[model samples]
Target chain A: MTALLTVDRLSIATQARQLVRNLSFSIAPGERLGLIGESGSGKSLTSLALIGLLPETMAATGSIRLDGTEVIGAGERQLVALRGPAAATIFQEPLTALDPLMRVGRQVGEVVRRRLRHEGLPSSAPAVQTRVLELLSRVALPDPERLARVYPHEMSGGQRQRVAIAMALAWRPKLLVADEPTTALDVTTQAEILALIGQLVREDNMALLFISHDIPVVAGTVDRVAVLRQGELVEAGPVSDVLQAPADPYTRSLVAAARTFDTALGRLF
Target chain B: MNGTAGSMPQTEGKMTRRTIPLSLIVGGVIVGLHLLAGLLTLFWTPYDPTAMVGGRLAGPSLAHWAGTDRLGRDLFTQILIGARIAIEVGSGAVAIGAAIGVTLGILAAFATRTLDDVFAAAFDILIAFPTLLVAMLIVAASQTASLFTAVLAIGIAGSAIIARLTRILAKRVLSMDYIVAARVAGSSWPSIVVVHVLPNIWPTLIVNLALQFGLAAMAESSLSYLGLGAPPPNASWGRLLQEAQGTVYTAPFGAIAPGIALVTLVIGVNLLADGLRAFADPTRRGRR
Candidate 1:
């Protein structure tokens, strides 16, 4: 089995200081990897570098090869080719991730039609609409017909997240990068969204790079876990090993934090 | 104002809210009347707008309507033609401004760091140079201050402001996550601009353009008043106002009629822009 994504000694830096330093990770085809980190851990920066969409002020060094193409220093045309069909990202804030002015259906349809165009298939209105509805339904959204007409502001947080998920899945990318996809939702909605992402990844047989600060959530979603602190990778291992007995002291602290949170919740119950 | 602007639409719903805005209604009526008067000039006026058809400084009557100007030309006829000229100049200048401004702005928004700075500096300098001063320079250069010259000067000068506005608006939209999302979804720059950026920014752009229309019209009248506008027989409202300045005490109607016409048009356009801004803003709409 070949690796779907390979990041080798990747370092991202602004003009003033380094943000992500000497980080390396790889995800094999159909594999799920969770990157667990604290704030300013360079987790988000690494994810952006994977898609070649880092902000202009920051410069990225080292190699990021996704499905055989090098993402670092790639031109916009090449990056555009890789973005949807190869890998797509779902950002933290679903409300801002989707376009507010556009109807949700049209938004999804835009991706579907682009995918069709990329595949050299006819992208007529009816054809696009059918596929759009199929994608909406696949994400377990009820009443795809009516939902497509309403704007993003009309939908709840969870529904909007589902729509974002649908958009990411529209092109059937080989890999999905979800950067704190459920962080903006409430407790109940978070569980639902997390489950949906896991189920969709499994159903599509797609690789996933799930970045989150939540330890238990990462453990539940991914097979392998990589822990990041500041700008460096502190630990990498199976979820069971990391959670049950962390090798690094930093990893141990993270597991202990998760345990404390679990115990607090247990006491509440 | 926010509360009133937001609530009125929700309570009225689709039926009335669509046109229920007080500014839009009042502005629409004033502009509509002006438009009717302008259109009337296409076929008829009381007399030839430039002809000496009545006694000079005569008062309003069935024959002369608003009476006559110093030259004995019908004031009512000149005022009607004035409306037509105002509309022509307003639309023409705005069209030119929007075209030049929007294109440059979008280009500047997409420009690299060095190019963007250059564009920004240029826009600032151009904006600081008064539109009237620029118009004077253009007239000086052309040596013929026709309606075309006025429109060109005003549009060119105003383009800097429009471009600056467009650059700011487009850059803000480009920075949004949805724009990144669109790109990730395989949308090309052109596609993203058409599908996302333009649709997001057009509401604000339109509101500003509406305001620009008023400014351009006023600028045209000022040019005519300064003797740089369309020559005699065109009967621009500014020329009428200028011509009536001396006889203002004698006729009173001469100055009052064109002054009222100019003010009404400007007020109408300004109110329309205000109404549009209130209606189109999402944050304000979200309050409802």
Candidate 2:
């Protein structure tokens, strides 16, 4: 009934130049929103601003309300308090997203313990470990016991991404912001990771801000789509409407580019 | 295919064995022997290190293996005591440097732009001053030139280099994506430092500190040679070297014994540092 995240005329600027200007959007609770854009299109910056984690050099003027807390100029204490419980982010590179020095289980266990504490539940070592393994298994990682013992470098990319996902889910946050999460994975692994994200979001009924440049991947993952170019929102609507009949020339070009690949694949087959 | 696979692992095993860096072994043995000698002196030496129990300028003999100095103190006894002092100065200085430097470096890494710049400038200024000069100044300011003062001065001087290194390493780690993830996961700053920053930086820090141990030992000796080290009744290697300076042709053993000890210890420490670097770096491990 209420919006999980609201961005009002969000404008982000570095000292030299403006990166995102006059952008507005809101995602209702449990809604899936795909933010489609090219590199430097300000999608990542916007996501960062949502959690009040913008780089120090960059400034944001717009208001970002996450479950009613104004994040634009919030104190670090407030932002930190809200970050894990309000929104959890999955970055582009899974290997780098997880601390390489730490074992996967401990990383996930940290979040699980925090979440348990946040929820006022008992978070003893055994309890925290159980939740960690459960979340790891929930992400379709087999032999959670053994996987927990290995470092991030020891795991394959997909496995690492799953560990990242497990960490994100450990918080049980209201919104999950995945920024090009599959971009670094191989093609087959990308599809698997995307499906995992989609299924997990559905099962948890968690709102998702799925950011990616790949049109098909975004299309298959999100319920509604918003197309951005050069930091401006060019188009926003249901997934089918935009892909089938894009109003903006930039949106049409993006759709056409993805379609061209589809047609080329069809011809090859 | 199966035969090749079986033999491939065997060859890989042999390669792994051979790849154990030679420096590590050599340095380990050398340091180990010195440590043994130092520890042995704790319970037993040929004679009281400062006592005139042996004949002056005597050559090596069963009673006194390294003969005796001009003071008629057993040379072997003095050398063993020197080993003890060397170990003490090395470990004490490095421990102090790491404690102070690591704290300052991590704090500087977390500092705001202006504050970080201030810290950087301070570190640079401190580093620009020669370590021995800084130690000399500290000794002059304190008006006392004992072993404690020398170690404290060397440790403080070395802190700047360690701090500078730590700041750079910490900044690099802070920029990594996992650090952002840690913050986003609500990790407190202290916890982040303890959990993420320290573990990530400690391996390289250890290697640098090992090298610093060698430098600190040398600095102590230099101070002693300049008449600022442990006072008389304590024969440090450098003090022995200084004492043997005038008697060069007559009894070369006096200079050679202590000189050999100092050089070997330094070489051993340097080799240990190099070996540690190769061992701790994961990228290098992969190549091997």
Candidate 3:
């Protein structure tokens, strides 16, 4: 498979602190790649740097190519253009990710209208609303029509996550970057959300870059896994190879920790 | 929680929860009184605000609701007419201060550099001087200040406080993920600020406006009392207070009438502002 999104020796820095150093990864067209790392291990920062979503305080060096278009040092307008139709992000906290004041339907509709405007297509409010409802339905949100009129704050965490997923898929981007999309969800809800993302990526034939610290969470969702520790990639291989037969000492430690944590949690329940 | 949930709509049942309605009523009453006074003055006052009905320092009677000042002008009528000037100055000055302050604050927050530093320094410098002193100096520098000039001077003096508040609120809103989401969605800076940023900070601004109305009213009255607010021939509570000050010992009602009016108006505004602050609080709403 050919790479749809590629990062070569990408380094991101905030003020005097280096976050992601010499990070290189790629997502093949229609492939799901999981980048697993503990907290502050540069996983999320690498993803943000790839999409040019890093704050003004941060600086990045090295190449970030999304479908052969270099994103490094791209102007804000250029980044904006790339954000919707080319690449989109699903943040960790869905509750915080979506705008509270705006109705979920309008927010989803905005992406479609914005993309249409960017492509110089005529967009009507009714037409956008219809498309937004359709997208919500596509995400398996029950009662799409009713849901469209509701604000983000009015919805449950699971429902909000579904809305966020719908928004990410609104532009039908070739690549979706999900950063701990299910971290805040319960175990059952987490399973459902991960399943939804996996199903959607397969159906759309879209490349997905899933970032999580949970080993089993990514194991069941992604095709390949790249493990990071202390801002460096420690292991990269097929999910089966990395999870079932872990190579790096850090990766083994993670697997052991995840198993123990799950066991402890199960005992608690 | 169940009892609280059940009382969400009923008036008596939700008395505690219905603070917003109560606030609206109070705000409406205060605003309505000011408006009615203004309209009545435009058409006619009970007696001419400037007219001397009898001897100076006359006590309250059926002919004069409040009494007569040293100049023998009807105190009640003067206050009724002056309500328009006081409300105008209070609301107008707050509007001006908020507009300038919120704009500069949001700009400084978004800019976040030497530009922000410059605005912060300027804001701090302006705020360092006592607001009354600043208003006095501005009024002193320009001889014969009109209603508009008084409002402007008060607004300029009040802007420093508003700007600092707006900057803090705007910075908090600017850091929210939805703001980042808007940016990623390709929203222009102005659009983001207006559509996303402004709406989020609107409650804060409303609370500030209410609080400032009370402050501006007191300031206007003080300035007028000091002979710096409105010129002669224009009715103001402060100016009325100044006129009655001389005869306070002889006929205390002369001074007491305008003084009471000023205190009542300020109290009403402050209470309404407090109510608004509570009404606009989301956590309080959630608890209910």
TM-score of chain A of each: 0.99, 0.98, 0.95
Candidate 2 residue-wise lDDT, A27-75, digit = tens: 9999999999999999999988998888899999978899889998899
lDDT of 3 by residue, B92-198 (tens): 99988988998888888888578888988988999999988998888888887788878988888898889988887888888887776666556667877877777
Candidate 1, residues A42-105: lDDT per residue as tens digits? 9998988999989899999999999999999999999999999999999899888898888899
Q: Which scores higher on DockQ, 1 or 3?
A: 1
Q: Fraction of true contacts kept, per model? A: 0.46, 0.40, 0.25
Best by TM-score: 1
User: TM-score of model 3's chain A, to 2 decimals?
Assistant: 0.95
| Candidate number with greatest lDDT | 2
TM-scores for all predictions: 0.95, 0.94, 0.91
- Name the weakest run of 10 consecutive residues (lDDT summed) in model 3 chain A: A149-158
Each model's Cα RMSD: 4.0, 3.6, 4.0
In model 2, the runs with Cα more than 4 Å from the true position are B1-25, B274-287
User: Candidate 1 — what's its lDDT?
Assistant: 0.88
DockQ of 1: 0.45
How does each model score on lDDT? 0.88, 0.88, 0.81
Chain B TM-score against the true chain B, each candidate: 0.90, 0.90, 0.88
Better of 1 and 2 by lDDT: 2
Superposed by TM-score, candidate 2 places the C-alpha of residue B22 at a distance from the truth, in angstroms, of: 5.3
